[model samples]
Target: MAKYSDEFKLMIVKEYLGGPLGYSLLSRKYGIPDGSIIKKWVNAYKAFGKEGLSKKRSKKVYTVQFKLNVLNFMKQTGASYQETAIEFQMNEPSLIAKWNITFIKEGIEGLKEKTKGRPSMSGKRKPKQSKQEKVISREEQLEHENELLRLENAYLKKLKAFQDNPNAYLEKHKQRWHLNSKKKDLN
Candidate 1:
C-alpha cells in the first residue's frame, strides 16, 4: 500500500480512540481500502505512542543469528507475525513474514543480508594475479571441495524428503506456491 503521513495516522488513531466509530467506519470515512490498516495504526499508537506511526528514517540491519532467534521464538511460541513483531519491538510485522519465507525457500543462507545498491566503480583496473597467486593451496582446495560436497549432501537430503512426501511438502509450503502461481498468472 498507500503510505499514510504521521499526522494523518495520529488523527485517525485519535479519532478511533476518542470517537464512537469503529475501524471499518473510520477506514470507510478516510477512503482506506482495509480496516485492518487502521487497526494496525491503533495498535502501534498504543504500543509506541506517536513514534510508532512515524516513517523509519533508516532501515535496521539484523544479524543472521538474530533473525534465526526471531524465527525460533515464533516457531516455539506459535506467535502470529504481528505478535512476534510487537514482542521484538519491531515496527513492521511484514519484515518477519518475509524472513520466514526466505528461510523456508533457501534455508539459513537466505537469511544472510544481501549487498544493496549498485556496485562501486573504479577508474583503474587491478593488475592480474601472478601464476603462483592464481594456484590454489592444497588445504584451500580440499576445503572448497568439502564445502561443495556438504552442500550437495544437504540438497540430496531435501530432495529425498520431498520425494518421500510430496503432498506434505506442498501442504507446508502451499502459501509460497500460491504466491508464485499468482505472479505467473500476472505475467
Candidate 2:
C-alpha cells in the first residue's frame, strides 16, 4: 500500500511531541496501525524537524495475489502474525500488520492490493488528550452517575412491564415463539 502524506505525517509527529498524545493516540488519530511508525516519526522529527517527517522510502509492486494469499492463509490458520510472515517468506511484519489493521477498520476489501485508483486517506487525525490532563470533566462525572440511574430505571421498568402484561410483551417481542415453532412442525 502507499504511505501517508508528508503533511499528515508531520501533523501526527507534531501531536506526539505536544505531550499526552502517546503512540497509541497517534496511531488512533492518524489511522496508523503501527505504534513503531509513530515512534519513528517522532524520532525523525526530533532529529530533522518537518523534513524528517517525510514519508519513508517505499517499493510498490503488483502483489495483489501475494497479499490476498497471505490474508487467506492467516484467516484459515488463525496463526500469529509472525508465523504467517514466516510462512509467506515476507521480510517485514509491517505489511502483514497493515493488512490486518485494514481488515479491522474496513473489511475484506482492505486486504486487497493497493490499486491505482484508491483514495489517499480514509480519515484524518483527531486532536489528542494530554497525559497530565484530567481524564473526565464534571459533566462526564455526572453523566456516569446518570447512566447508572438509567440502567436501574430500565431494569425496574422491564420488571414492571413484564409483570403487568407478560402475554403482551411476549406477543409483541415473540422471543418465546421460536421454541413453539418446532412444536407446530411436529403436529
Candidate 3:
C-alpha cells in the first residue's frame, strides 16, 4: 500500500508549485520527515503531470537490456539516480540505485530478472560419501592441529604482554584510547 495517497501527493505538489514555500518549509508544514520527498513529487509532477503522482498498482518489470541502457545513460550523462529514473520514465529512482549497486557487485549477470517466491525443491538428492572419503588424512589433521596451536601460542603471548603492562601494550598497539589521547593533545 502507498504511504501517501495520490490526491495528497497532488495537493502537496500543487501547494509547492503555487506557493513561495520551498521543499523544506512545505515538508515541515506537512510534518514530513524528509524534504526530498516533496522535491521528488514536485519534479515528477513537472515532468509527468498528475499521473506521475499517482501510485502504480502493478510492478513494472524491465528487461536486462533496458537496465543496461539506463545504466549506460547514467554513466554517459553523469546524471543522478533520480534524473536517470525520470529519463527512463521509471517511478522508483531507488530501483536504478539498486541496479547500479548490483551491477557493481555482481556485474551484468546480476541485472537479469530473478525468479520470485520460494524456489522449487529438487527431487534428486546427493549420494552420501563413503566413510573413507569423509575421513581426513592423519598428516592433514596434524597440520590443522599445529596451525591451531600456533594461533593459541600467539594469543597467549599477546595476553601475557597485555597482563604485564597494559598501558605499554595499548600505547604500542595504538589502541582507541591512545589514539583519542593523541587527538586531544593535538586539539
Candidate 4:
C-alpha cells in the first residue's frame, strides 16, 4: 500500500540477506506487515540487484522485442509470471501475466502493444450521398410534357402582351422571375 524509497528497500534487503534469521523474525523485527514481500524483495535483489528492489514505476512502455524475449525465457525456463516479472523488474506482475496470455493466444505478433486511447473520428466518417432512383410511368411522362407545353404557351402569351405593353406582366411576376434567374446563376 505504501511506497518505500530505494535506499530503504535496499537496506532492508541487505539486512535480510546478511542475517540467518527467517523471514517471519526479520519481518517482526523490521515491522513489515508481510514477510512474503521481503522474500520477493530478496528474490528481486538476487535477480536484478538493487534495481528490482526499487519502488514501483508507472505503467511501463515495453517493446515488442522485449516482451518476446521475456516470453521466450519463461517458456525455456518454465518460470511463473511472478518470478519472471521480478526477474525482469517489470512494474507489475500482471503485466507479464497478460503478456503470456496474449502470447499464448496470438503468438509472437501479439506481444506488440496497440496504440492507446480513443481513436479519431475524421478518418472513419464519409460524406452523405443520395441513392434514390427515379421511375416515371409513360402516362406520367406524357402529362409532364403536356404541362411544360402549357407553360410555354403561357410564356408566349405573356411575351406578346409585354411586347404590346411593357406593364402587361405584374411587377410581382417580374420580381419572381428575376429572383429565379439569380438562383440559377448561383448554381
**Candidate 3 weakest lDDT stretch, 10 residues:** 123-132
Task: Flag clash pairs in model 1.
Answer: none
TM-score to true structure, per model: 0.64, 0.29, 0.63, 0.53
Per-residue lDDT, model 4, residue 170, is: 73
Question: In model 2, where is the ten-residue run with the lowest total lDDT?
Answer: 55-64
- Top-TM-score candidate index: 1
* Candidates ranked by lDDT: 1, 3, 4, 2
RMSD vs true structure, all candidates: 25.6, 26.9, 19.0, 8.7
Residue lDDT tens for model 1, 58-139? 9899999989999999999999988888888888889999999999999999999999899789777788888677888899
Residue 169 error, candidate 3, Å:
84
lDDT of 2 by residue, 1-26 (tens): 34788888888877777778799877
Native-to-model Cα distance after best TM-score fit, residue 181 in candidate 4, in Å: 22
Best by lDDT: 1
Query: What stretches of model 4 exceed 4 Å from their correct place?
Result: 28-31, 56-60, 82-94, 105-110, 118-187
Better of 1 and 4 by lDDT: 1
Query: Looking at candidate 2, what is the lDDT of residue 9?
Result: 81
